[model samples]
Target: MATHASAEKRNRQRIKRTARNRAAKSELRTTLKKARNSVKTSAQDASTATVTAQSQLDRAASRGVIPKERASRLKARLAKSLHKATAKLAAAS
Candidate 1:
């Protein structure tokens, strides 16, 4: 429990920020999962999902819910997977 007035206010802010960050992180995870799964399917779907995931990652990073470097790494990985999926599809057809 926070005893001083300033401490209580800080605790309140911490609680609010934690909840907001948690929700953003959860959404980011869900988006990433969708993007990864889509990459296993067709190229068109994978590309769209990857774009969406990248957008979400950028938004999370800008809001400080996630680190910028982590977001960049994830975006790169998503792009790489998308490229691989497209290449495999092209070879098959």
Candidate 2:
């Protein structure tokens, strides 16, 4: 229970920010999952999904929802996995 006016306002802002961050994080997870699934399904679909997931990660980082380095690392890992999957498919054909 915040007694001071400023504290109350800060509390309110915190609540709003918390909800927003939670939603963004949830969306991020969904995008990541979609990208991973697409990688296992098709190369074309995986490329599109990876791009979408990378964009989401960038946006989340810029918005302060996730750290920049973490976003970069995730993008790199996604790209690497996609590349390996595509290469394996190509080699098979």
Candidate 3:
């Protein structure tokens, strides 16, 4: 319940931004999940999947939706997971 004129405009801006914000966040999560799934499904696909995930993370960082360092950290962790999974697969085979 903003009574001021400026507050009304701010509310409008918030409304418009909400959808885009949600979309961006959702896209980021979906990309990350897809990458993780791809890695888990095929040891051979890990490299390509990691690459795709890195791209998605970089895009998000560049757009200011996420910090570059945070994106890099996530990428690093994902790659590490992929590596560990691949190593396990190799050991098992």
lDDT of 3 at 73: 99
Global Cα lDDT for candidate 3: 0.88
lDDT per residue for candidate 1 within 50-79, as digits (tens), equals 999999999999999999999999999999
Each candidate structure's TM-score, on Cα atoms with residue i matched to residue i, is 0.97, 0.97, 0.78
User: Of the pair 1 and 3, which is ahead by TM-score?
Assistant: 1
- State the weakest 10-residue window (summed lDDT) of model 2: 36-45
TM-score of 2: 0.97
Stretches of candidate 1 exceeding 4 Å from the true structure: none
Winner of 2 and 3 under TM-score: 2
Positional deviation of residue 85's Cα in model 3 after best superposition, in angstroms: 3.3
lDDT (CA) per prediction: 0.94, 0.98, 0.88
Better of 2 and 3 by lDDT: 2
Clashes of each: 0, 0, 0
Model 3: residues >4 Å from true position, as ranges?
Answer: 88-93
Show the colliding residue pairs in model 3. none
* Candidate 2 Cα misplacement greater than 4 A, ranges: none
TM accuracy, model 1 = 0.97
